[model samples]
Target: MKIRRLASQIVLPILMVASTPALLHAAPLEPTRGGEGGRIIRVTTLAKDGPGSLKAAVEAKGKRIIVFEVGGVIDLQRTILNIDEPFLTIAGQTAPSPGITIVRGGIDLKGHDVKISHIRVMTGVDGQAKLSGWEADAFSTVAAHNVIVEHCSFFWAIDENMSTSGPRFNGKTVKEWRAATSHDVLFRENLAAEGLADASHPKGEHSKGTLIHDNATGITLYRNVYAHNMERSPLVKGGAQVLMVNNMIFDPGHRAVHYNLMNLEWAGHDYVTGEITAVGNVMRAGNSTAPGLPFLTLGGDGDLAWYSKDNINVDRWGNPAPMFGRYGVTKAKLIEKDSPMASLGGLDVMPAKDLETSLLASVGARPWDRAPDDIRVLFFVAEGRGEIIDDEKVVGGYPHPSPTAAPFVDKDWNLKTMEPKSGVYPGQKGGAQEKLSARDEAMRENAK
Candidate 1:
């Protein structure tokens, strides 16, 4: 599990640099042009909310792209930043070295057509009492659509680290429920880890990962890293259509990926069977993981129609682990299929064996300027040394990097995607360096 090469040294997929037509065709799961022809709005200060604050820029009227002139943590004072405006793009990559980090709070995406990348969200306990009902997700989409969240780091959330969810039963019909909830969203190449257990959540010891709430549709989680969290690396609830592809989950407490639909929650509405397509995923046990924990756990009163293929589940010693389990009083039906109902026709999905190498090299925000906490977490995953924690204090709490600011030059980047037109990113010295392909890497390894 050791990452033999640095992230910058690995050859990333084309999606990392530019979008292709195939990638774009990944809809209704793919995100649309988010704030792509919008006016540029610069966040010139690190204030929580003011004239030049990130909050102000997000709350601004009309379609806009929010770029940062300052770098460092923006302490929300335990408050959440709600993005209620639509068609917004937050280009955190435009920030100076050691890119933008939001701490002591979270971001709630309630708007449609939003794209955010290269940002870190570290929501610690903020001195709140344990089991006192204080909870926050590092990032979440609430009944929003056409959104993309990439290359972000989420840590220390009292609830799920990152999630796409909304009102479970928004309308009487399943189609209405799907429309009203979060859907058509993409979460790619992010790191979701170290949720705080037994700290501030009212439900004691609740340190989950991601929760795709009931009835949400067209959700795709691709190439993300989920580590050191208790469970729900994502839990797909009833009637949701989800595609979990090429993701890595390490050190889960009790479960890795699961599905459940409690009878009480869907008392009035009939239970619609959920659909899950899990492909090319890797789940490894770690220190805090439960013994003999199944890679996919099915629970509750209803059944789930799932398809799993090319997924690897192993224990700490690299021993093979169980693949499936059930956890409810009633005998819930488990529908296993040979092929998926829906196809990831346009996305690039690698084999499970190649997943760790790609993930270790690219997951998380600002790989070129990773925070010490993120660096440690990634290293721990490589060396297999970290564990699920009860508090963020165990890992030195939130960071307070000395704030740095620099002027942004809009001409240097493509305003639509915020990518550098000159092929040189912020932290790079010159043109992008050459990367080793998989074959070349394998040859080098053999030589060693």
Candidate 2:
């Protein structure tokens, strides 16, 4: 009996020690799970094209996971990559130093099941004068589906910073093609700033933040911030199931939330119709916007379920605005949960101070990629520094002035000089290239 007891005790201790590591390792953090258990691809350069470049890394075909070895600016130099692969993950959080930044060029994701996090993409030009204001957005998708874009910052584009659309399919623009091309898109904890005004639009103040085109669905914009822009703080058209919860809009030039019913230019030809539900959002209007600038640009055909529960809106004086919208109901005390879209509602609406603080700390290219100057010139206007100037100082900027932040860019929407030390670091060639190894060993993961 003594020998048996001794053996049992010894075996039990050994088993406990052996199983502890396995158990601890099994519960990885949520950030590590973003790859969705796909083949990992490690990127080692900021090159625009070719091997070790972001373009090539994204262009490669597979259920791939991409991690950055170096954190620097990838100057596309007027080039834009059209991503056509499905089940891809661009894990910007893997960058040890600064994270990845894409400038001049943009990524047009036209695939499915893609996830991107903790990255920055910027188009330098202010407006569409260059490239006719088309194909030049920080991140755009045409017929892309199930995309999760989180913890990213987009700004300084001639058009909307981040947008989803239904491109021409089978040489025709139809509902079926539009539906298949884009759906189930999510944007969380992101920043969309400084949209350039379009030359031709009704308001003439035609900058866009999140422009959802016809034929999109399950488009969720959660806990996002839009700053220093004109119209289209998510201009939606074409029928889609949209949930915008816990978002913040600061110092916009015009009204937010313009819902188009494909009634205007596209009209009958290519109109987007969808359900829109906005709740627990914060809108702060500085001196830049009109005194009575509304929170929503009413007028759409899609089903809309509007709840104003637990929202914070302040005017230029930092006074809580009584009305949330110029068109819809002003103050909503309690969100009606009896609707069918209860899950889309915000669980807890964050206060303005908390939301602002959260954005200031969490937005952009994570903590590592931020330069000292990034805060001073990150969004449309430097947050505290770019307070609204006198409206009369700028034209068409009637009660408020236009945006005043962001580095000067060339006409082609490219920054004239990408200072390595300022924005994303520019790694010197032949330097000890940092290597972000592919974590998925089950699949053949190799870096070229």
Candidate 3:
């Protein structure tokens, strides 16, 4: 079904504006099985358009299987596959071979108990790819009960160097195509890449009741790299109730984890009530040397504001010590023999102690360790004479603030400058003076 633009705009806003009322009145989605009780159809024959073949299979039997033996391209041009039946399994004999591409406008599974695996969805056409609706969305199982999308790669082409002036793209600014929502979905072992310069949508977008565990969700991501996805945002306002764990999220466009609660003004729907757990997940910010800001941003205008407690165990920097300098060190080397991050948090969790030690070691010994005998003695004396500034408290007050903390200190530990630092050791100069200024500014800003 084509989504009405007006409805789409109104729905998101209404969800934000009437959050309380909608939560009180919103009905839970009924559980369903997408043709779980039907016959199986092996898709041995390759079709230029896979969706048509899938539709044909569904027509033959209310429930069936579409298997791909010799992987080939299956294109779906803005067509919707509404598998309204129940108990269906579209299994692949094996993951799609390197050359195979399965393009779809979108796959909507409204039934119950459906499983689709071992497929690759490419949204861009070879020559006719457009800024909008190149592939649209590969899989969208709205209101479907128990849906699974595994071992699949959904890719779009994006060109970061282009400049277009229009709704979705304004010159150098990047944009994404608009599409329908996919709910109750499980995306595992998938790779999504944006190759085009003007593709209008982010890769890996999903709705409520979605689980993206153990998947590579970004560019240059390998099979085991579960990079942060720009597409996913929690539908519930106030907080996210999703469980995200043990995923290796690398170089996300935005913050590794985002709580999508801003649209509360539209539908007034608020399904989130508590913290969304991001345990044992590796998150990295993309390295883009552009005007855009890096690092994860929690909430902004048109976005829902959540209490700090609503975010559960999110290790902002997954790898305590990302590769230092030009060379990279193995995790085994940087961590101490019996570091807490190495074992205590289980194989999944990486603790703060481990994180700190790893980072310090990667950057070489502390100033004391590097100092000559005279300097070392002087350093100790300096430490004894200088006041110890509680960095944790200062940073905590302005969590994730730019310019960080290194620049605000001086030899005497007195407040100095307010302007952000620049140069080789940017935030390392003016010490106490800079820090106090920043602290006061932050406090005043908070008060305002």
Candidate 4:
């Protein structure tokens, strides 16, 4: 309760300035059904705030769905946009041509029942010196719940590309910790890549992918692409429950999937074990990957409840690698299980053998309208290229997506999934495919 109270105090001032979140008249539905049948809010500007901007729409509240009438980069001006309202849907699929890309800032979810899809976020260095402490996550949940994030692209973050965070020990009991922290979250079919290693983070060397922070519960990551991040693809801490299925990890530094519980953080509290269920996942070593790194590593001071099935680990040359390793200095315990305690009933859990082929074609935000950066990242994943960079400028920096705009016709889309009813996504023709072809042609010319 103290943690919750502290969070309220910090957020209340922001809410007071932005106006308190409006309560939606409709009852909240499941995470997948976020903002269904709510008012449609159109974002028509690239401004960080004010009318017709994303920050304004999110701060306005109610069960609302955001559709972009403009397509371009929204320079957040190095400010993290906080979503502290519930029952919201951010439908980036509605953007015209090359879709919405948020640059120089990050999204912080502090609300419940939110669904975000088809968006790209690039939180770069913003002219900060290396290790100068200007860290940011492309997207993160702060004690938020019932959230679903899919078909998004995250890059160049100084901190973890995407993560779930809350208090480590909210109360005296494990149940209280579970209740107070972020829960029932899902991230699928996204690309988390190129986290800036040794960038603006104060600690330095913080190029991470996804981190399910301590006490977060019921988190599921399915069919996502994790490429070029140094580590944490991803790390699950103590008192958390996570299910990772059919995800692809490429070029992780020393870790791929790991579990840890720091004793210093839980000094006064009793140790609450973490649970992980990994199925049909694939990890391929690349140029930046540490030699002889295992697919999954167990570390830290506490024990872990783990279940792994049919996962694949291999080097770039197709040589098989270690499946598991122990990296903790402490004599930590491992509780291996015959079956997964968490269920993946609704997930389309595919085989590890077919993961790379399946993900390469359709990963990241607006796969049909992919910017050049997304294309390059996917290409690098396929070719076993690219290294962990300390800065975003190493890979051409932030792209300049051509600005375009068009009316958003609600009848043309399936509101629930935010997919086009006609089965033709924007920029599907004469766009991303052409860029890919051009890139290939240039590569061939260079080979000569």
Candidate number of the best lDDT? 1
Q: Write the per-residue lDDT of candidate 1 for residues 1-448, one digit (tens) a residue.
A: 2212223424554113212101111233456678888999999999999899999999987889999889998999989999999989888888987789999999999999998888999998877898887899999999999999988999999898999989987777788889999998889889999998888898889788999999998888988999999989999898888999889999999888999988889888888999999999999999999999999998988789889889999999999999998787775788988898666765677789877866776778876556778778877887888998888888888898889988889888777557767655565432222345699889979999
- Model 4 TM-score, 2 decimals: 0.90
User: Which regions of candidate 3 are displaced past 4 Å?
Assistant: 1-38, 48-52, 59-61, 78-80, 94-100, 125-135, 157-184, 195-197, 200-240, 267-275, 289-296, 300-448
Model 4 is weakest, by summed lDDT over 10 consecutive residues, at 1-10
Q: Which stretches of candidate 1 lie over 4 Å from their true place?
A: 1-29, 429-448
lDDT of model 4 at residue 49? 95
Of candidates 4 and 2, the better by lDDT: 4
Identify the runs in model 2 with alpha carbons over 4 angstroms from their true place.
1-35, 126-135, 167-178, 198-206, 265-273, 300-305, 322-342, 345-353, 372-374, 377-448
lDDT measured at residue 174 in model 3 versus the true structure, 0 to 100 = 18
* Whole-model alpha-carbon lDDT for candidate 4: 0.82
Instruction: For residues 1-448, write the lDDT of model 3, one tens digit per residue.
Output: 2111111112221112111110000012212234444544545444543443556664454655554334455555545556676666664422123223454344555665676544444444344333343334445544444555543444432211000001211123111210112223443334333323323333322111122211101111111222223323212222222333333333333333443323333234322222333333333333311113222233422322222211122223332332111111211111112211111111222332232212111111111111111122122222222111111122121111111111122232111111112212211211111123577899978998
Model 2 scores a C-alpha lDDT of: 0.57
- C-alpha TM-scores of all predictions: 0.90, 0.69, 0.45, 0.90
Query: If the candidates were sorted by their lDDT against the true structure, best first, what order would they fall in?
Result: 1, 4, 2, 3
Looking at model 1, how many pairs of residues clash?
Answer: 0
What TM-score does candidate 2 reach? 0.69
lDDT, model 3, position 43: 50
TM-score preference between candidates 1 and 3, better one: 1
